[model samples]
Target: MKRRHFIGAAVASAAALGAPMLRAQGRPRVVVVGGGAGGATVARYLAKDSAGALDVVLVEPNVVYSSCFFSNLTLADLRSPESLEHGYDRLGAFGITLVHDRATGVDRARREVTLGAGGVLAYDKLVLAPGIDFVPGSVTGWSEADDEIFPHAYRGGAQVALLRAQLGAMRPGGTFALVAPPNPYRCPPGPYERVSMVACLLSRINPTAKVLVLDPKPSFSKQALFEDGWARHYPGVVEWIGPDAGGAAVEVRPGVGEIVVAGAVLRVDVANIIPAQKAGAIADAAGLTEGGWVPVEPLALATKADPAVHVLGDAAAQGDMPKSGFSANSQAKVVANAIRAELTGSRAFPPRYANTCWSAIAPGDGVKVGATYSAGEGKIAAGAGFISQAGEAAELRAATYAESFAWYDAISEDIFG
Candidate 1:
């Protein structure tokens, strides 16, 4: 099939069947908050799969979504940030209402969502996929205001462009320092992959430059694979300090461009600080968060706080699933299927989830880790998984990088067309 026609054909086929005779009198409404991977996929799937039976609405603050999945490539100059931007016109074409506004509050008792622009939307089913918000004061001397000097760029968009500019402006032979977040944050391997990209860029423009990573966690996702790739691809250019080595005991002075690690001070030319994150503010307002994240039933992804409200993506504390775009996309499908079955009396199958996280170590070097999951004891548990091994051939790594690009295009089409 031609790539251009894929989304139109899918929507046309679903509409052709017409909506299954709705079980309820009026059309049920499903309001999705956030328009990233999880929310967008659920909103699109719910509307597309149900045809006209469900009134699907998506609330997003931005018209264009800059994906964090491949924003690292922008830093490496392998891809442009503009290329990562996606619009919602495709969702609108599928008959889903797109509301360009921030979701400020969720009135669970009234079953409505309050928008920043002063409107309330009532929903029979509400899916909160609001992604993550940084925990205030999680990183010392760093706030949203400091982002201009020390770019986190974890959420992509403008922060990514800022970080890219900082990298470009760095002095030759200078130091670039990164503070990686602990576990349970979005994209477990993101910080490491970012380090690789930074090294790749610095190696070309400033071969004498150094890249330092201070990670709060003792171990990281794809640790061995990334370490091996760093050694072979950009030897002696990168260094990592784990928690055992006082990585967790670090503070930054963005004004002075200085970092204190384990009581020792080091001056750096650039700093990227990724702090602890929690569910979006609306999730907390709705009482969906317990330990900084929303807990959900594995099978339906309905929030434990309120079954009428489903949570997906980084905001969801689904055990064993890394908080990556791919994970959110996978979880959205399961939630959409469950919601469809409930609203239309359609057949519902046991939920099965799958995710693959691909990290580009350099221009032609990529590694991946993925798993298939199933519901067990109220949590999503990993069943089988694969990880790139050490000492793989260069051709295989190149193929893996190509696969990541293909997956990005395919998934973006599936979500936004």
Candidate 2:
């Protein structure tokens, strides 16, 4: 639900999960952290291409990972966690070492990675791709433990289960609150889409149940599409609280199951709080994130803080781009390619990025966004991007949504099928 809980639960354990102690031979060691979209992608690509030349060690707590990208569709009963859960069984074929441990620290000077349980793992080049983390004291009266009472579902899987259970237990006409964090958090359009899907779920069982969006910002991605879809589909079932409407959640109390916003006190049956974030702590422990997120030489996707370390995914501070799974996965390619070139002493290729975010508006209809990126002086810049048009044609919308499924499958295939 909350990003850190997923990290702690999914990636915090090592030896308990039965990771191999053996290191592949005759290859440069490559260590990867957090095996969601980015870390898994990097590990698969590197191990596949490099094989014996590069030993890819993936540090992740979960043997199977469920992606947040399509988890909202699960609310519509269009998909399941099974649709997103993936394992790196093929990594062995590519000579990748799978470690079920969270990276606790990095030895930049020694070029080694320290895991929570597995101790020190030597790496010729380390790849850190752990996903987002909630900012400490993000909302007043709400610390990490409040997570037990409110499930964010920003990080997918078990959090989805918790939120679903809460939804199931609530009264038919109960309120579901979607508390959106400030800008630059993971999955820019995630909060709105989540509310829409939750509305879809509630509308089926309880037409009177309402989905309330308490947004920090004045604007959101695909607002027109979401508004029209809500109006035409859910009608009075969904309401959005924007800045003008004073809809920001300034504080939350799990003990009371309430959120204090602008000037209103709205009690909710189910609360999803997407908090502000930073790069994973391993980056901070290693002094990689200077201005909060890791600042990188956009061209190489290499952390200027430590050249031996490359930070990709939600952790890397790429300005303007939303901290998203797609962004991280796209950035993984650039970093992986750069790492390949660096290890092989080949001509470095100019980096390019591809990102696509898909949000399920209904069971069969979805809105999508895409973009291309190139490295600039200090930060990565968007070269080209597109968003799905409002009030989509049914055939095209269905096709586009289907393409989202294809994209997930293809991306995972490229990463770790």
Candidate 3:
């Protein structure tokens, strides 16, 4: 509907009690933690759409955010590392107060947030999109302390660069191993897409180098399509071992650079160990999480613990939607509209969400899976969906790959600007 037209209303209704300094500002404030995909989009939308009706502040420790979605291509040398990096300066243009500090705690009773830099922000509404943190002891004989030896380049930025350097320095014909995480993690097709990208690079540089994928699950998203692409592009160089073949039980030896699988030891030159993950630590500290993820009402992503506190992206346990950047961005728009209507007497439209995860199997070869969602009684329910087929034409795959680049650019602008 004509939701973009904001009707003028009394601004006093949106104000919430806070410290004298905050109250003196005389406007409703929205404090968004974690300036990644969801936080950035919500903050930008709230401030931009409100037309100076609300005071919005975004709290992020890092000045530049690197997207995890396209970092795989960077590892494969298809995308430049700088292309993934984005600054929050543009977000400031929308009059959003950018707080470059980590959110240490949330005082839900008083509606205040403590910052790592010795300050506090009081807000009318709070949005937490802190993404993910690794779950401790999920993998045997390995921890974040060993990340230097066995890097998990799951997040974008320097970790991906480090893994790329290690790959380049590996001895010809050496083995590159990947330990995929279990289910309910961010990006279902992420680990598998990474394997394909690594294979793409190794096949060109080190033809004899082996690419090994040890997955804990019996199958993964688009398994048939990935298998088909691997068989055609990098046959005899890629191997996938699922739980049926003892892939679930594995141990890493950082000292000796070896992996023990099903009581058998295999030496490897490079290892990418992806351990289990949970909501960001801030979610736990705030006491908003149940079972490591913040449970939220699907209508507006409002946390069950506190309706004023909304959680989004990987940190939230909303049903049906996969934890991808696209999902987060979609959820953010719904949240922004809901919050604006609550705080500014703006229009409230029915919430609708959608997500699409596109994976580049090889150079100019891509596949995708996507779905539309609606809020159900107790959870978000998936509606119609689509997935790439096993025997797609070469032209379609290439177009899919090209479509991914355009999506990246469009989403980047949508989030930052």
Candidate 4:
């Protein structure tokens, strides 16, 4: 039942079971591992588009999915955590099989997936959308084991709730320290957006409090937009340190609630340590990873190691796309089309992908960065990018914020339904 027992168990299982499991009812079966934005969208699409021609099975350990996309809003009291939770009951109407179990391993040779619940699923096509997992020791003196004292709140659900509770209990005039991760992590602008939201929360209740951002990178997504917003709204409240100022040199002591930046120790009331990340363990279990991510062909998102297995979302190392939910949902459509074309002989069209990441800096104030993508030069290449500019009109910013709300509703429906 161990999730990491991949190669040895898969090889033994393949040897014992000489023939691949027959497709259910003689229809091509697509097994999607992970039920986040990418998996749910692709699953719903395949079932809806194929019209019962293909059997779609989605394997996810959780019955309810809490999105990390807007969890920051919860911290600022703009949204409640319960509002972010979505159940899978709606997907049942599509005739997709929902397996509430963790995918332990993938047997590429036999085309079977091992589940933690002691079951196996055979698939003609396998999709990995497991998202990101933290890299061990990426942040010195901080680890997942110490997350209780210093919550990362990177993933949705309990962790976010914990961080929110800690923030709520923070003393007046306290310091909130955030350790941002490196490039190629999920939601490039997420940590910064969280900082903005936190500042908004504290500005009302704890005006004397401080927000510290320790970033390993020199600059981040939507840097100008965020910096300008911070200065205008939360002046003298947020301080950001980049790599040149030893932002990269960080160490935390959860026991004492202390963090060392550039060999200087500071005690903080709350610390959100977002460490480096990699492809989820399931991708590694399938032996499809390279350089902490799954290398995928641009057109269909198929893994370089095996064409039958496609990687999506944060787990995929496809070029030019920031690891965001919008990007994943966009990639899912392309993957769905390519998968359906191959499995059910459906008409395939040229793949076109798009993504827009929106960040709410303050109440009714939002900024965004996005791009369109297409397959080129063995990778997903960016084209026609757009971003929110500094010094925008308040009405436009409010409209942009309203647009993000609509997008959240639309995309959630598109994913869970």
The candidate with the higher lDDT, 2 or 3, is 3
Across 290-316, the per-residue lDDT of candidate 1 in tens digits comes to 989999999989998899999999999
TM-score of each: 0.94, 0.91, 0.94, 0.95
Model 1 residue runs over 4 Å out of place are 1-25
Question: Per-residue CA lDDT of candidate 2, range 1-417, in tens?
Answer: 111111233233333345333334345667888887888888877766664566677888777888887787776667777888888777656666677766778767777676676477767788888877889787677766777788777788888878877887789788988878887788888877888888888888777888888887898888888898888779998888887777654678788878787867778888887777788788888888876689888886788877888888888886556777777777787777889878866456788887888887886787888888887768888878899998568998889878888888887787675
TM-score, candidate number 1 = 0.94
lDDT, residue 381, model 1: 94
* Local distance difference test scores for all models: 0.88, 0.77, 0.89, 0.90
Which regions of candidate 3 deviate over 4 angstroms? 1-21
Clash totals for all models, in order?
0, 2, 0, 0
Cα lDDT for residue 344, candidate 4:
86
Task: Please state the error at residue 396 of candidate 1 in Å.
Answer: 1.0
